[model samples]
Target: MYFTFLGTGAGVPAKLRNTASMVLTMPEYQGDAWMFDCGEATQHQILHTSVKLSKIKKIFITHLHGDHIYGLPGVLGSRSFQGGDDQLTVFGPKGIKDFIEMSLSISSTYLKYPLEIIEIDEDGVIYEDKYFKVSAKELEHGITCYGYRIEEKDQPGTLLVDRLKAEGIMPGPIYREFKEKAAVTLPNGRTLNSSDYIGPDKKGRKIAVLGDTRICQAAVDLAEGVDVLIHESTFSHGMEEKAYDYFHSTSSQAAQTAKAANAAALILTHISSRFQEDDHLLLEEAREIFSPVYLAKDFWTYKID
Candidate 1:
């Protein structure tokens, strides 16, 4: 899994940054990619990377802000013309479906594939499958904004190769059966239990993506123990007043949420355009409060080992 910042600036575009947009890549899912906040001209940002429109199976919008969703129609429309045939599922706060439907309807744009939109509310599991589960929580934004928690499902225990070999089991279809917990009879007329040969279950990775909001306990709880946290730092510490006035978060505030959550790493994004001249300073401010802090930038990609 990895994250690529397609755009990091908030509200308005700057010379250095576009708007809010990020791509979460899951290599194990056949290069499946999920996007968070498709700001204006987001498809153009994908031009600089290897991200394919076809690979983007899901999109999560933080709010209904123009900067967060202006690029949705264009991206969705272009994908149909660009040979994308897979289903696209979009999850966001309420009014998301209406917005997408109106946009495509007004423009008379037809989609070549299935387009599904799920309006999010409250703090609970929004999506789940054999591979991953996505949850959402309400934030302290002035309006109805949400924070998302994406957790990979715990994987089955690793097969014990040594034990299998000791039992005279070679790597074959039988090994798959054993992994699947299918009953297998050993040469000695003894049944080998799958649980006995399977190691401990591997914990899945967790990532928290928060929308624009003030410092709130709900944010911390939603992001608890996340392997990576992508939080918005729309203002610097000294600009706390402005952040509060605008229902945004300061660098230190975002760091505090990550600290309380014990997140392994923090990627500060949705930066206010006001700090364009001193983007590094904004990053430094958050780093002072949190050790493993990264200020997101346009087209910046971070891979998780």
Candidate 2:
């Protein structure tokens, strides 16, 4: 899995940053990607990266702010023009359906693929499949905003090849049967349980991606024990009052939340244009409260291991 920041600026597009947008690429999902937020010029940003419009299977909108959603219609329409026939799903707050529909309708944009828009009125598991489960919780953004948690399902353990070899079972197609079946009967008429020849299950990774918001309990809950916590840090350390006034979070507050949640690492994004030159100060503020903290930049990609 990997996280690629398409645009990380807050409020408006700056010379160095665009706005709010990121892509989560899942190698296990056949190269499919999930987009979070579609700020203005987001499709343009994708042109500079390996992200494909056709490969974006889902879009998760944080809020209805222009910086977070203005590029959504363009992305959706362009996907069709690019011959993306796969079904696409979008999840967002209640008014998102109207915003998307209105934009596409007024522009007379036609999609070549099926589109499903889900307006989240409450918080819970919004999506689930065999490999992953996505849950949402409301955050303290003044407006209806959300934070999402992506939990990858645990995988089956590896087959004990050495033990099988000790039992005189050489590597062959029959070894595949040991993994697929609960019990495998050898050529010698010995029945062996598959569990006996398997190691412990591999724990899945968890990630939390939050929308623009002030420090809140919901953010901590959504990020609990996450391997990666992507949070917004719109201001520096001394701007706590200003951050709270604007319904945003400071670098220190974001780090505090990560520390409280016990997150393994923290990535601070949604940076304000004012701090473009002094961004290092923001990073330093966050690292004071939490270790392994990163300040995200546009087009930067982080591999999740």
- Candidate 1 lDDT, 72-178, residue by residue in tens: 99999988989999999999998999999999999999999999999886678999999899999999887899999998989988899899898778888878878
Supply the TM-score for candidate 1: 0.96
Candidate 1 Cα outliers beyond 4 Å, as residue runs: none
The CA lDDT at 92 in model 2 is: 99
List model 2 lDDT by residue over 39-148, tens digit each. Answer: 99999999999999999999999999999999999999999999999999999999999999999999999999999999999999999998899999999987999999
* Candidate 2 TM-score, C-alpha based: 0.96
Candidate number with greatest lDDT? 2
TM-scores for all predictions:
0.96, 0.96
Residue pairs clashing, model 2: none
